[model samples]
Target: MVRLADVAFAVLFVGVVVRAAVTDLLVPASTLAGIALVVAVVGFSLFDPDGGDHAASLVVHVALVGATALALVLVLTDLTLVSRAVDLALFYLVVLALVGYRRAPLSSTISLFPYLGAFAVVVGLFLLHSLDVSPGSGLAAFPVFATLLLGVCLFVVPRYVEADFLLRFVGALSAVIVLVGLPSLFVGSYSLPFFSVSPWSNATLSPWFVGELPVLRSIFPNPNTLGLLVFPAVLGGVVDLHRTYGRSGSVSLFMVVPGVFLAINAVGLYLTNSRASYLAAAVGLALYAAVVVIDRRAVPVLFAGLAVAAPLVGFGVFRGVVPIDPSNRFALWGASVEALLAGPTLLGAGVVNTSELIAPFLSEGLSGQSSHSSYLSIALRIGLVGGVAYCLLVIGPLIHGAWRFKRVDVGMFALAAGFAVHQLFEGYTLFQYGPGSILAALVVGYVIASVVPEAT
Candidate 1:
């Protein structure tokens, strides 16, 4: 039954990817076949209660992958109607899966209060503010809401969805992105029939790099997105290498696959030239090393060195020794802070048109569509209360795991930590429906399941 579920997931996942590409190519037969596969998968899961339990994880898991793929396709091609149709289908499929699993233990539910509460607060504020917005804006906000719903669904996956399946899911997802994205740097085109490139670039972001270098977006909408999307795969590959080496007590042929995978993804990450992602990757890998690679007793020394080095690094950057670019983010962040201070302190403006929400507060000539920071974006959209909830949602697992150190899966926890810091500069956290958001949901859920005794 699990094998059947796995086969269905692969088919549906491929169908989603192909359906997005061909939907713009006007291939209705292929598109309809994809829809049919979705129906068959859902029907198979629903009709066979026993099979449904086995397939439950696939429903949410595939939905997130499908959602991100469709979103990117929608941006690069003319598939508005197909994207909406698939989105609705996947949303309902998840809801139905949750409905079937009505036996969730109270302990599991309570363990996830941070995630659930954050979702509720964000949605509540959004609804209140969206009520006053125009219909188009309200419609635009639906995807953000949908993204959060799918992310939280990660926590409730049935017991039948084993850890092995989860590991395979992360590995496969990373492999696909890295394998495809790396080749795209040389072979893929950003032109019509393949993709319609957005005119966005790092050059436009700051005066410091006006024409210094070209941004490598690869198959993604932007470099930053691509960088963030590849981050988890790198972490996962690292964990695989460590475990393989530990089992053999030496680097062997078994370690080569993960080593190569990590190296490729790391290269891809560097090519993206996304500084935020660089910081996130560094922070996550550092934590993984501290917890898993280094002795626990020596951890304080390592952190103390970092504490001393951080101020020196900052001072160097401040003194023009590092030549790093701020990318005008300070202005954007200031505008958001100003708007938050102006009014609507408790329940913020809304998730829709967040850039537009802060535009009024921007200094005379500065411009941006987002706060560029997920933490700021959430606070700007749902207010301080929601921001705190989100923080807890991202940080609670790490804290709990650290407190009960023996039970923690440090690899998963470090991935979550990377995501937590990644959001400090990027907006694809709980409120955004992108690849990063989905990965964040999966990693955090896996960490919670790892640490909490009752959750497993």
Candidate 2:
């Protein structure tokens, strides 16, 4: 099993790195590259040793490279969902491994509550539409329904897993995103394939055209996604670097090495001009430095308190807890709540057209801003209860874990802080974009794993 596992992992790593460095090499031959990646992820999960030999066992690691590589290639081709398919395949592999071998993933019944809450909201809302729930015009269509369940499932994965696998996944993903994004620094703005030097092809979005100079989106279509993808990894890598090459008194040389790479990532995120991500990265880095300055132990309490309060407090930096009068987002939030109340009693109008749900909310004076808040979007779509469930089911465990790790690891908590802080403005959840969902789940999962008690 060990030898087979080694061979499988070796094949997977070589194949994925190739796929990343160069994409769709098998294009004319079909998406054989994609196929190979999915197969490798499955194989890694099945053959890797039990109890993981690490401090904890996690299933997310099996498909880490596979999933990340697939995502890169798909973007190069201007695609979505194809890479996520690798995660789906890897998940199925985990299911089969558990069924055949009874290898349990770190089970969390508490995580199931969010699922139930979301399910109840979906069901109750749909049923109420038949009874003509007020303030609502029609039920959520097919897209919203798919979103409701799909979002829940995506969030559920890490909650049930061990932390080691998920964190390794985060670190690896952060590195890949940084690598892909580096091209923008040199080439300015071009697709992964970048076949035409001519800018008017309409085939790809060149960031340079948006401005007089290249801002860097790397392989992604938009600067916002690039910022979101690279920033968290930058934060996480800093934390890991300290632990790996860390020493007391003076800053470690090892810290300088990763710092150089982190600087590259920071530059990429900066050139994106993704204001929200830039702000988040700044905050995360500040927290990282602050932890270094102060005590690591205070991170949990401070972060937890902030996380708890951020949602309620009204401030421009905090993603607008309550929309001010006449603001675009405020108007959107008002409309979405109206629609939610009118449509379904508990469940949201389904995941479909959640953005549209707030359309009526946008006043002519608001200047075309929709719901800029992911927090509001969830509550508006899933109903107030579903939103609360998510806060508990998803955010609760991870916050708890971050608090626990405050005793030992400050970096992880700070990275988590950056992620949570940024999402307030941008929708990086699984349902929002490819990397967003994966990163969000793993962030929560790893933190939760940190807090879990070992065998008594």
Candidate 3:
């Protein structure tokens, strides 16, 4: 029994897709694949979460996760229209899905203060001149706000999808991505025609190198981004493998396959040589182990330990013991901070303004100086208040969910925690709706949704 909302969503989705196709007749095959995926995922969003145990719901579950995974992978490409379409469709779905749903109790609704407050503050700042918005920054503004909207959508859509299914799909797809890209180590580069590997068509040695070795970005825009995308697979695969081991008490195909994929993800992460991702992997796995091996009580201890160690770790980075070259990151961060303070209000500089302000700080001949840290990026864009709200949006639910410690909850919490940690080093977490941001939003949304009480 389909609801009226289903017909409405389908009609609207088709209209949007057809208009997009008309606007860009020369769209690549991968773009089409991405559009199809967005449709499947969004279309399946209409299903009630209670139906998740049924066979039809099971198929829809796989389709939604599979479509989301593939579409996100395609997001790394240069397809503008598909990216826009995905953002719009996601926002619409999130808004429409809220209709007819039971409201959470006041306590649960109040838990949303961080998210709502942050959004309101940012928009208020934008509407007023509290934060400066640069001319021709619509490109930056559109995606940032769109990403914020889709991030909320991820939270809503999970009310209708199985978080467990998402983990399994992530694990399976991570293995596939790793396996497909592994050959690049020997072959120098790997890309198919349909992939439309940006800047050049055929495979070529990546201009970027990690300590003399050509980094393996594979299908992603950079090695760090690839590592960002693959680390979740490690967590997802672990969950699947753990379940298989617990159920059978012996090796089985389910165990063997995920095990192999887990290894592949490890190798993939290694190939990227991303220290940030490596740290993220370690942090995520440690959290998972703390919960499973020790107790949920250990989760807070681990976080406390990490917090204490962060400053000491900075000392190592400065001393060169960490093997990380600051790569002028400190300079960029400092410049961003200075500009943020120079603003008229603590609401901070808007997106384009922040980026443009930091440009001159780059060393001569260097350009594109984005705040490499997501935390810093948010601070620069929306100031300390908004940054705190974003942090709460990411971490507050993890703390609440930590109490439950169910399988899906634990796996997603670990995944979301790791992604959050990754943001300390990488800038692609919140404001960017690209592959890494999309994956993070989905995982974090699931974690938050799993812990939140649902309407009947």
**For all the candidates, what are their Cα RMSDs to the real structure?**
8.0, 9.9, 8.9
What are the per-residue Cα lDDT tens digits for candidate 2 across 144-231? 2223223322333323333333343445555556566655555654554532111212223246545344555555555666676677
Q: Please provide, for model 3 over 1-456, each residue's C-alpha lDDT reduced to its tens digit, 9 standing for 90 to 100.
A: 444333332332233223232333344323433443344345454554443334565464445456444333333334434444463344333332332122335654455455545544543443333223442244424443344334434544455445555566566665665666656655555457534222222223443453334556665556676676678877777876876787999887767767887888877777777778888888888888877798666765666676678778877987778877877667778777776677633666655545676776666654676778887777777677767767876776666665544523677778888888788877764544455766676677777667665434
Give the runs in model 1 whose Cα sits over 4 Å from its true position: 1-109, 133-148, 151-153, 157-213, 248-252, 295-323
Per-residue lDDT over 343-436 for candidate 1, one digit per residue giving the tens place of the 0 to 100 score:
5767776655568878998866775567887888888777888777777777777676666566666777778778877776776666443457
Candidate 3 lDDT: 0.58
The lDDT of each candidate is 0.58, 0.49, 0.58
Pairwise TM-score winner, candidates 1 and 3: 3
Please estimate how well model 1 matches the true structure, expressed as its whole-model Cα lDDT: 0.58
What residue runs in model 2 are displaced by over 4 Å at the alpha carbon? Answer: 1-214, 247-257, 308-313, 316-327, 365-370, 402-409, 431-433, 454-456
**TM-score, cand. 2 vs. native:** 0.61
